[model samples]
Target: MSKISTLQVEKVNTHIVNWLITYAENAKVNGFVVGISGGVDSAVTSTLCAQTGLSTLCVEMPIHQAPSHVSRGREHIEQLKKRFPNVTNVEADLTTIFDGFKTIVPIVSDSDKVNLSLANTRARLRMATLYYFAGIHGLLVAGTGNKVEDFGVGFYTKYGDGGVDLSPIADLMKSDVYALGKYLQIPNSILEASPTDGLFGDDRTDEDQLGASYDELEWAMLEEEKGKISENFSGREKTVFDIYKKLNTINQHKMNEIPVCIVSNDIK
Candidate 1:
């Protein structure tokens, strides 16, 4: 059962398509360039971009990505191409680049730290790849982050997946994204697959990393918005609420703007 309410699928779809088209026209860009991760967010975002009748480039930057993720991503892209003439795709197998980066970086004693850092590195590498295509093609990099990940828990890596010219679905919850994905007629392979960032080069899911399900997190976010505290809950609800609060607190760095030092006039 989803904690988020059902969306008006057709109206939401039309609104997002129009928004993407308007943003692109104002920015004077050719279209949107989305990183397809074989997840619901990317599927919906790329589909929305495609509906604008603008050139939507779905770039697959796989850095030791799992086989399932790759296949699902390709499936969605192929379906998109067949459905929309404005859609195109390119796969940049970044496994070699990622390995080369590890060889050059200094060896660290902490295996855990190194593993996490490398995972984020994979995302940063993909970000650079997306910008590369965006630069040459005059397209804006469309972010695939949803509301629960982007605002609720800040699950994205800083300046990695977090870096984007515009976000088409950041305002929608994970369930909302799934709803949009269904209405967009995305591949069942993607619609049914467990949500994973595919940054860690393994099958560990987003729930495994977050220690909570998207539905639980969504409920926690709503409670927090209502000024509820952990003291008000008990059992698993309290545990999940605490998890959400802790992540929301720690990831404020990613959610907020980069801090700038304001030089006082007297200092000069």
Candidate 2:
């Protein structure tokens, strides 16, 4: 697509800020509770919420989190507080909670299965923590997921990071989030930092796990959405398209509501 202009970015910023304020007001909520993961997506989403002039509680939920990653998240909150007075910070370390689960459960030797299960558990723990704060304060849990991850590939864990009361950046592409981050003048350290889920202990980035760049995946997603995949087949283009399709098929469940077994009244 075309390069996003400064005016367009500003407009988006204003739109999201206004939307957050209006959404909260309509819901009769006090403020927004967002999990600040020190990633660009969270940085931008929290910044938008802060700009709304509403009370924004930026929670840092660390479960076996790296010191550097935790520092980045705290730094972003500190920087945001300087500009936005309504911003607040809270750190909830869930490492103990996670370790408790491991201690009780039988150790599984399957590396991939065990790692993924723990990563997802971390996400769910953070989700629970965010809601806990939101519940006590009567606030909404603002999600940090962007379009490419939430919709294009469903990269978020189901009922984990994907569980939220509101998603301010869900419609924004990853590139667009970067543009907004720059527009809002987010902390440069966060901007320069690699986007990782911080779920894995290995420091593997989202792209590393996805096996493709956000730009490539986004392009393929856009093409897939337009239903033009069958138009032509080439080398790299075809490869990207195939990868996008595979991700969609694998993650389609996440994009939809939870499935339930339906029963007939007569049968009951």
Candidate 3:
């Protein structure tokens, strides 16, 4: 086991909580907003927000693709209520909303493409709901991405799950994240869940699809930057290698700022 600094970790969490409250205050909102997906990242964020003495609202926005996530989401919300008695449990069904919108949004006939599109559409629709509620209730949306994910293969959807007024866990790595959860007393159920986007079925986990565990990928990323490379790795190394290559290839648009048409130094 690595010699992780518990005190330093505690300080970081404290800073994060303080920052979140300040962000909500600056946004002219009474508290923070969040989406709990029966996953650790959101669970931690929601708990921290509620403990910050802010009026936190945790919205469970699972779609039809994965009802398991909905069950888990309810479990998490109930757990959050026990841990942070101040957070509101807002259950919203995004399935009908997405279904209604799908008609106007033309999609390719490809089944795989359609599934991917639906997965992403659900995320964006949920975010829209969060923002709408945040606006009406005077709250700021809290993002739940972590360092391991932020550095590894792009996991979050742009403008969809990625839309947030503040992110509390953007610096903590995955291994370190579990420890924080323990310290915060987050329920075992959420902490133990195989991390996922819940964009599809129950089996659609992040590690399986991303082709690598968060630990290995994060290590590779940090080492590569320091001109140090680990040649010896398990079979999983190949998975990480392939995923890193694939993300670089397919998610290239994420590497650039939003599309800006470069033209002859001429303004229209």
Candidate 4:
């Protein structure tokens, strides 16, 4: 993939910041509240929110989170506070809350299903925490999803990380997010860290679960948009295209709006 130039980066930065300011002003909200995940996406998003010079709250809700994730999240928050006076941070440790939830929930025989459900629960807990802060402070919850995850593969948990008042960077690809992160001078620790949801309480990466990397998925998405099929490629390319197609097919529920049964006037 081609790298984004410096001029493009500067333009995008200014554009997103101005857009955020306009949205907040029109919505009659004070500012934005973003979840800091010690990853490039959240770091870039929080930085953009801070640039608006509005109240930006960086909340860290860790539930059995990795130590490295905690350290990197705190590092970025401290750096953001120093750079923008409008930036503030809070840590809501949800470890005990998670444990309590597990104890109360009934046990299941399928361990894999149980584990997946619990991982999603972690994301939902964080989403609720962010909304609580947003409600008390009159701020909008800013989402940190990129295009590849949000639309291409439907990688995020529905109503979990997907639950948000507004999405700031959902249109940008993963590579574009990193380019913007570099332009914003985000902490290197976060920039270099592997992308993970950190919901499973382990060191598994996004690739480990997705069976393909972001770059590969991005390419597959573009190819599919151009009406290409898996037969058009061979070797690892074929494998990646198949993987992307399977995920995109199965995750349509997350990507589409909730189904609502409409009744005719006669029936009513």
Candidate whose TM-score is highest: 1
Best by lDDT: 4
Q: Which ten residues in a row have the lowest lDDT in candidate 3?
A: 1-10
Clashing pairs in 4: none
TM-score of each: 0.98, 0.94, 0.86, 0.97
Give lDDT tens digits, candidate 2, residues 1-268. Answer: 3334233798898898899999999999889999988899999999999998989999998887888888889889999999989999888989899999889977678988988998999999899999999999999999999998988888999999999998999988888998889999988988898889989977788879987778878888888887777447588778777877888889999998789999999999
Clashing residue pairs in candidate 1 (N, C-alpha, C atoms within 3 angstroms) = none
Question: Where does model 3 exceed 4 Å of error?
Answer: 1-7, 65-67, 103-107, 228-239, 259-268
Which model, 1 or 2, shows the larger TM-score?
1
- In order, candidate lDDTs are 0.92, 0.88, 0.75, 0.93
State which candidate, 2 or 3, has the greater lDDT: 2
Model 4 sits at a Cα RMSD from the real structure of: 1.4
Candidate 4's C-alpha lDDT? 0.93
lDDT of 3 by residue, 38-77 (tens): 7888878787788798788999876774665667778877
User: What tens digits encode model 1's per-residue C-alpha lDDT throughout 1-268?
Assistant: 2575589989999999999999999999999999999888999999999999999999999887788998899999999999999999999989999999999999789999999999999999999999999999999999999998999999999989999999989999888888888888999888888888988878899999999999999999989999999999999999999999999999999999889999999997
Worst 10 residues of 1 by lDDT: 1-10
